[model samples]
Structure formats: structure tokens, C-alpha cells
Target chain A: MELLGYLGEGFATSLMPINILIVMIGVTAGLFIGAMPGLGSVNGVAIVLPITFIVPPSSAIILLCAIYYGAMYGGAISSILLGIPGASTAVATTFDGRPMAQQGKAGLALIAAAAASFVGGTISVVLFTLFAVPLADVALAFGPAEEFALVLLAFTTFVGLGGDDVLKTIIMICLGLVLSAVGLDLISGDPRLIFFDQPGFYSGISFLVLAIGIYGVGEILYTIETQKSAPQVTPAKITFRELWYGLKEINKLWKTMSFGSFLGFFVGMLPAAGATPAALMSYGIAKLLSKKPETFGKGAIEGVAAPETANNAASTGSLLPMLTLGIPGSPTTALLLGGMVMWGLVPGPMLFIEQPDFVWGLISSLYTANLFAVLVNLALIPLFVWALRMPFTVLCSLVFVLCLVGGFAPSQKLHDVWLIVGFGVVGYVLRKADYPMAPLVLALVLGPLMERSFRQTLIAEQGNMMAFVERPISGTFMAIAALFFVLPMLKHVKRLLRRDLSPAE
Target chain B: MITGARGKLRACLGGKVETIMLTADRVLAAGIMVLSVYFMWHASALPIGWNGMTGGPGGGAFPFWLSGIMFLCAGGIVLRSFKDSAPFAKDDTPFFDPDTLRSVVVVTLALTATVAALPFAGAYIAIPMFLLWYLKIYGKHGWVLTGALTICTPVFLFFFFEVTLKILLPKGWTEPWFFPLYARFF
Candidate 1:
């Protein structure tokens, strides 16, 4: 009853004319940005954060949440039409979606993708509505000790679980944390990293500047190296007859769709697992469950549907930890977390109770956006495919200009624009060298919180190390964090021991 | 023996690429190790807060400890780099080709130039100049198209960002020059 009552209030708030108009604008713009190569939802959302400072907080929520979900839907369009994925999550979609397009089944692929995304997004929101408040209720009881342990768990999970190489990821996370320490110390207000006595250094590096520099300009530089010209793409359109047939196909494919959505949602809850793994895992599962497993790579409609569904579900499902535990499950959520923080809405269990209207209104708006995404994608797939055919050079140049504007808009600071340029070059270099970027962004946002909780706990226990494990909730979280770090090391040690112990060795 | 290792690295990198990439693995590993030391050094100067006392866990405690951990990790990377099994140990390919590197340097300069111009020239003037250079010089599009895009985009940005969002972008030292134009929007 409480859930429904809050949701009803949320719906009323979200359905207001102003909210609806902005939400539409957000999603439509998100779709356009998402469809463009080198500017995914992360860059698009980061670019819009400055503008959110101008809007009412609730309206800002409606706009941003719309962008997040709408970009997930739009990511599939470029993946299906061009071989290039619009977002990292769409990489799985391209494994089958492109082949289907190449076979002249582009219309069918488009409809199936849109339909699966709708179902997956709708399911995740329903599940989120049911479970989010309860999770938040539990999280609200956490003291600083538990919160520190939780942040530790998130960091270790990324280092140990997210990447192929552990050392590289850890180094990246540490570097981000170090950069975060550059600002005026929270408790003492002493500027630490400002070796140069500049006003800008006093406040520290802006995440918006780093984000625009890295994701926006960094991506442009990356693309320009490998590709000199844009690939031509033919627009794919669906007919009424095909739309009717898609309705029946959806019924037949319900099992695969449900399986993908469920698996993806669970993966999304794991810290930093994100949509790529969710989609890949579901695609594998779908192939395993299939009667004709060999048909997977070659142009299976089920292949197209499964990954698309899972990715959309995972994108929404990733929000669970972000909204409830105050930890972002993926990089996109991390940027969203930063945006919320900028609006003076600290994300935590307290968020649900303190701003029920903002929380529930955001949840309600997801439902609205998911439905709108399906309708828009179905109607405008051809337009996006055409947009894909536009000059890549022009798009890169435009993004370059936008990054400049976005970096400067926040405080109208020339130094901030310089930061964008500096970080853009840094991002491109690190990316080329194969350092993971997601953990870095996640760590940057969570850095101050981690430090604060850590100090608070240290103070509470009067500097006793055992107090961390003394509390039940914090103890459990700390134990899990230990396990994530230890398990990998244990595996490596055992392998070395086996090699040494073997007679062949 | 060193030549053989270098040969293997070159094989991984492709023969035509830069020689710096051959030693890139060790360079990057050492680079991070040095960075970690720098952080630890600065953090050591701040109060390593002992309790709720000493100004609440001291300003330096978190960074000092974390940077120490980072130092250990950087050492691990260095150790790993020497092993043949490391990820980029044999990778010798140029990080970016010559043309690409040239573009990167040029674009970076263009951005720096834009920032330099922002205070004196304003967003309206600086942005168009950057676009023209990017499109014509860096991107190599013709005058008719580049001219249209360069002229039109700043005007579009002005309305969407300033007029709609109520966020004033910098008018610059020439703020009074736009007094007549400013009366229309506010």
C-alpha cells in the first residue's frame, strides 16, 4: 500500500505538463545523441548536467532519467544498421543484429530489438518499484562503518571482477582517488593538491570537465585514428504487416526474452558488472538453451532479441544499487550520481525517505520513457539510420565544440575548459594504453564519501581496528570485500603451487 | 639478448611503428610508480589524523595510506611488465600513427587557443573561430559548407543554452558591446 501510494503521487508529479514536455525533450535528444557514434549516454548525460543546474530538481530528474533509459533503446539502432555499436552495451547486439541487417531483415531486426527493449525496460521498472523502497529502508540503518565497508566492496569488486587485468584497473582506481584528494580537505578546508596557488586548484578538478574531456573529446581523437571516413548506411523501414507479425513473434519468443531479462537484472545489481556482461551472458545462455545452437552467430532473430532485451534490462537494473545503496553499478550511473550530487540530492537510503516525490517520480518517469522509447524507435528507425550516414568528421567537430561549451558553462571558467582539454588528452592516452576508464570515474565520484566514512568510523572507534568487524552489517560487508580481493589472489597462488608441485614442472 | 627482446616487441608493434612503443610497458609502469610517490609525499606533510582528535582522522591519513597501497600496485605492474606473460610486454605498435598524432597535437592547440580567446573574444566569437579551423584545417571540408556550419552553429548554441536554460555563457571583456543584443533576451 505504501509503495502504491508513493507511486501514485510520483505519477501525478511526473505527469505534470512541464515534466512531460521536458521528459520528451530529454528522451528525443538522448536518442539523437545515442545514435551518434563516439557520444553514448555517458557523454550525452555529462553534457546535459550543466543545464540541469538551471531547472527544478524534480524536472531535472525527469529529464536525466529519460536520457538514461532512452539512450539504451537508441543504442541498438546503430548497432543493427551499421556494424558500429552506439554504446558499449550494444556490442552484443551487433554480433547478430548486423548480420540480420546485412541479410535484408533490417526491419525485422529493428522491430524485434525495440520490442525486446520495451519488455525488458518495463519489467525492470516494475521490479524496481516493488523492491527499491524496501532496499532503501534496510540501507537507511547503516552507520558510517557499514557505508565505508560498502564503498570498499564496490571498489574491490571492480578491480577484482570487472577487468581482464587486475593491476591496471586498481592503478586506475587509485589514480582517480588521488585526483579526488586534490581539492580542499572536507573537514579542515585545507587545499592539499594545489602546489600552485590558484583559485581553481582550491576547489579541485571538476568531474564534468573530466567527463567531457574523456568521453567526448577523447572518443573523437580515438575515432579519428582508426577511421578516416564515415561508412554509408541504408535506412531500414518496417511495414504494418511486419509490425503485426512482430506481435506474434513476441509471444513465441517470450521464454528467451524473460530469461535474458531476469539474468541481466541480477548481473546489473553486481557492482560494476554492467550491461555488456549481462548481454553477453544472456546471449550465451540463449544459445545454450536453443534447440539449434549453431544458428546463433549467423543471423538468428533470437540472438538479436536476447542481448537487446538483457542490455536494456541491465541498464535499468543497474539503478538498484545506485538508488538504494548510494553506489553506482556502472559508469553511466556514476555520472548520474554526480549529477544528483550537483543538485544537492545525495544518493543514499536517506534519498527515498527525504525526497519521496523525486524518487518515486523518477521511477514513474522510467515507465513513461520506456513506452515512449518503443513507440519512437518503431516510428523513427529509418531516421536514425539516415543520421548514421551523416559525416563522422562533422559529428566529431560538433562534439569537440560542445565539450568546450559544456566545460565552460558550469562557472564560466577558462581554467575549466583547459581542464577539459588536458583530461581529454589524458583520457585518450590512457585508453590507448588499455587502462580501464569506468572504475576511474566511479572511484572519482565515490572518493570523498569513502574518505569521510572511513574517518568517521576511525573516530567512532577511537582508532581501534577491530571496530570495523565489531558491527554486524559492516562486518558482513567488510568480509565480502575481503573475499573479492582474496579469492583472485588465492586462485593465482594455487596455480603457481600446482605448477611447482607437478612432476612435469 | 636485448635486441631479441626488442625484436619481439617490434614484431608485436609492427615494424613501421615508433620505437618508444617497444619500451612503453616499462615506461607506463614506472610512470605510475613515480606518481604514487608524489601523492604519498604530499599527503605525508598533512596531518595523518590519529583520532576524532587531531582534526578528525587528519587530512593526510586517507591519501597517505591509499597512495602507499598504490605504490605497491605500481610495483606489481613493474614486475609484471618484465615477464613475457604480461599483456603489453610484446606490444610494439605505435600508439597512434604519425598523421593521427599530428592531428591530436593540432586539435589540442586549437582547443588551447579557444580557451585563450574566451576571456577576450567571448564564446560567440571564440566558438566560431574554433569551428572554422577544425572544419577547414583539421577536417578539410570546403569553404561553402564549412562557412555555413561555422557561422550558424554558435547562434543555435546561444539560443538553446542561454535563452532556454537561463545559464549565461561568458560575454567576455566586450560585455558592453552586446548591450543592445542583451536587451532582447532578458
Candidate 2:
């Protein structure tokens, strides 16, 4: 098949000596980066991106993708050992992984995490390989109206499906969209919301600035507020026998594993629904399906396996949209898209056809990276556990320093540092108030793209509002978006009606 | 009613409760609502819709529409904030205890000072000053730990970011001091 040929060529490219070495270094670096407190895939990629500039596009992408996979897998190690999620996606892992560590089964916990991550990542890569080109071909047919509708659908799902507080989530998302609108229009060079005629206002607020601000500094501040010292860590080594023991136990939990992989991949494929929600969704479903539902969050191996597997799958799944449709499903992918752009390669429908080598090489290399990550984690479990031995004070300070460095790295502007500090405070306050940051950040990332598409759609249709729901693909997406709004209101109304009809108890 | 949600927000200047006011959520929501109005107002200053030139929208059209949505959402948040009783939304719960308030102020001020100093004192000097103040003054650690970290942090940053990655980190007046190191590395 054509797919086989492409993959064979991809292998030839990925298996080159320099590319393999880069993958090894990228994965190793990502592990250490993810093992650190408050450093996720976004931070890992953003910090190391400059180094990859010297390489060719395929190699650069391979290195960044390898880092992404490594960070996604490494996220579980911190959760298992130190009861801290190194990444937001790994938050669910802390529930059972930490408990497993507390119960003196740290070795088993690490292996479970590594094995589950490998399985999820590997399966998702297979899915990506089979489906990406076909999906891109479908996307290539989409016009501005359809693209606008699709992004609109993504927005509703983000707020509607992802958050607990609908009103607050709505407000947060609207705020992000508005904030993103505060610069010169893309088509028209006229400034929209430039406050003081400063040159800095010409260019919009970058996602890199926002991401480092919210996730990096904000996370550090939040960690400091609810500071718990790491539990006494005895160095637990993962032997081959223990690794087999863990995998054998995980073998019985195939149902949960499957649920996590499928759910994560599906959610990950969505632009709005990312790894955090995927992990949470799978964990919730696992508990619902379990005979011993009460065993969840109490050192359930299924609990550790499900979320660890899911976040990785979701992380992988998020890439599909970016590669196929030019929409970065997650922040990590957004950064990767930036990396791709820096290498003079645009990520979109045309990318699959034009730059077959880079796309296929990245995809095929992910397979190698996933396997490498498993081997690396399995071999270096003891070393990762040693990272957990760091004191909270040292961890907290170092994280703040890294945030400062990472914030300043991209632009080398003090403005970004100020933004990081400002948003750090805002993020901390928002988190404390129980407002979700996911919807806000997602909106910010997609906001400009949505605006550009909307304006273009309006222009193309000559200001006809109905065109959004006229085109077949756009119409379908808009109708689904309408359902997202309607279903919630219908539920609220039904509850109100039920209350009115019921007699007093 | 006694679940600590439905109560007046009484501020304590020293130790005595002052006049009661709005809950934290309501106050925050109201603040955001005001901000939304401001953004919406400025956004509307541009041509609000189609410019009738080449079938293109005015620069402000998208922002104007989005800002309108934000304004409405902010209003909704303001109304809902009063009724919400989630942890940080409570009327009675103090925003910060005295000690925590002190720590927050100190840390925030320190971070701000560091950022402000970056263009003046540069990353090398500013970072160490921040770290020293944070670790020793705020964190109250031993001099040895504080001193060691302060000295080593910049060296590590220099080697990693400058020597290895080739990123020209901002160096202010003391940029001259970095020139020697830059020559060594670059």
C-alpha cells in the first residue's frame, strides 16, 4: 500500500544516525524536564526549541516530538513518587500512583506508569498513521465558513464539556477571546484595541507568553500556597522481574486500559478537549465500570494505569488536528506548530501532500520515541525516584527561576516577564476561586484563528450571516454547536419544571 | 446557614472586624465586569462592522462582537458570584490570614522588583538578588544554602542558555561585565 511505502521511507529518515541520537537526547531531556515540578511538555519544548533551530525541519520536528512524548510519559513519575503532577495531564495519576508509592509498591507503580504510557502512545500512533492523511484530505475541502463553524464548535465543547462552572467558564473564555482581540487586525493593518499607541500593542499577546505565565509561574505560586513536603522517599529500583510483574498485573486491567486509550485518543483529537479532561474522564469511567469502585484513589493499579495511559494517548492524539488541519489541539502542539513554522514548514492540509517526508518522519519517529521512552523509563526508574528526593523549598524556588528564564527566552523582552508575573497572580487567583484555566487558554490560542476565519467567511459571503449554517459541512458543525448551547439550557429548564411539578416532601 | 457561606465579609484592619462588604467572588466578578465594559467601549471606537470596501470587515468587527460577548458574560458572572459558595467564593472566609498576607505581599513585591530590575541590573544580578532575598530573607534558610544557590544559579544559566544554546540574554549596564564571558562563550 502507499501507506506502507511512505512509512518505509519515514523509517529510513528516522533511523538515520543523527536523527536517532537526537531522539535519544530529546527523550532523556524531556524526562528530566517533566520530572521537575511545574515543568510540563509546553515548558520543555519552549525551553529547548532554540537548540533545534540548527537542525533540518524533519530532525527539528523529530526532536521536539520526542521531547513531547518523553515529557508526557515523564509526567507520571512525579505523580507516582512525589504526589505532585509535573504536568496538568498527570494530575489524575497522583490519586492512585502516590497511594501506591505510599504503600511501598513504588517500583510497581513506576513500571505500571511506563508500560501504560507506552501502550497508549503506541496505539494512538497507529491510529494517527492510518487516519491522518484521510482526515487532512477531508479538511482540505473546507472553506472559511466551514472552518469558522468548526472552530465555534470547538469553543462550545471546550466550555460546555470541559469545565464545572458554566458561567465562570464562559466568562473566562470570553475574556481570553477579547484579550486576543487587542491588537491590529490580520487583514486590515488598523489597530483594534491598542491602549497607548505602544509598538508592542501592534503584535498580539503571544501564546508562549500566556502559557509560561499561566502554567509555569502560576503553577509555582499555586504549589507554594498548598505546599506539602514530599513524603520520605526510599530509592525503589525497577528490575526486569518487577517490570514484568507490573505489566502482568496491568494485563488483567485491559478493559480500563482500552477505555483510557480510546477515550484519550478521541478527546485528544478534539481541539478543545485535551489530556487533563481525558485523564479525568477515563478515571471517572473506570471507577463507574469497576466492580470495586471504592478501590479507585486507594492505590488501584487500574487507577494508576488508566490516567497514565490516557494523558499520553491524549497528548499524541492532539497532534492529529495540527498535522492535518493546522489547528493545534493542545498548547504543546501549538508550540510545536510554532517550531514547524520556524523551520519554514506550514502545518495544514497541504503539509501532508507537499512535505511528506517531515510529516511521515515525525509520525514514524513517534513510534520509535514511544518505544525508547518505555525502555528509558524502565531502565532509569531508580534515577527518576531520586528526583523525588528533592526538598519542596528547593523545588519551589528552582521552578520560579525556570519560569523566569523560560518566560524571557522566546522574546528576550522584559514585557514577557511582567506578563508572566501578572498572569501568574491572575492564574493563582483564578485557581483559588475554582475557575478553570483550560477554557481560557484554549480560547486565547484559538481566538485569533477564529477571528480571521470569521472575518474571511463574512467577506467571502459578502456579509451574509446565514452562510455559516448554509454550507453542508459548516451547517452540520453549526447545528452541533447550537446543540451544545441548547442541551444545557434544556437540562436547566427540565430541572426547573420538575421542581415546579413535584409536591413538597 | 452556618456552613460559612452566607455571611458578611468583614475586614479586619488590625484584629477588629470592620464594616461588612461584598464576597470575594462578587468583588472579583464586579471588577472583571468593569474591565469588560472598558474593553468593549474601546473596541466599539473602530468601525463596528463591514467597511463596504472589497467585502472586507472593519478592523474592529471581530473584536467588537467578542467584546460584546465578554461584556454579557461578565454581567452573568457578577450576578452568579453573589449566589456561589465554593471555597474561594465565600463571604466570610478571610482572603488571607495575617501571616499569609505578609508572605504574599513580600513574595509579590520581590518578584515585581526582580522583573523591574531585569533591564537595569540584568538577569545575572537581578536573579541572584531575588533568590538571595527569597531564600534567605523570606525562606529563612541557612546562609550556606542561600549563598551557594545565589552564586551557582547565574553560572548555570550562563553556561546553559549562553554557552550552549546561543541565546543572547539581556544584559543591562553590566552588559560590559557579560562581554568578557560572552567573548569566552561566543
The best candidate by DockQ is: 1
Extract clashing residue pairs from model 2: none
Candidate 2 stretches greater than 4 Å from native: A37-39, A42-60, A228-230, A287-297, A342-344, B1-22, B83-101, B140-148, B163-166, B182-186
| Interface RMSD after interface superposition, each candidate | 2.2, 2.5
Best by TM-score: 1
Name the DockQ score for candidate 2: 0.47
* Local error of candidate 2 at residue A456 (angstroms): 1.4
Question: What is candidate 1's lDDT per residue for A232-320, written digit by digit as tens?
Answer: 57468899998988777777889999988888887887766888899989899999999888989888888988998898888888888
Q: Tell me the docking grade of candidate 2.
A: acceptable
**lDDT of candidate 1 at residue B96, scale 0 to 100:** 74
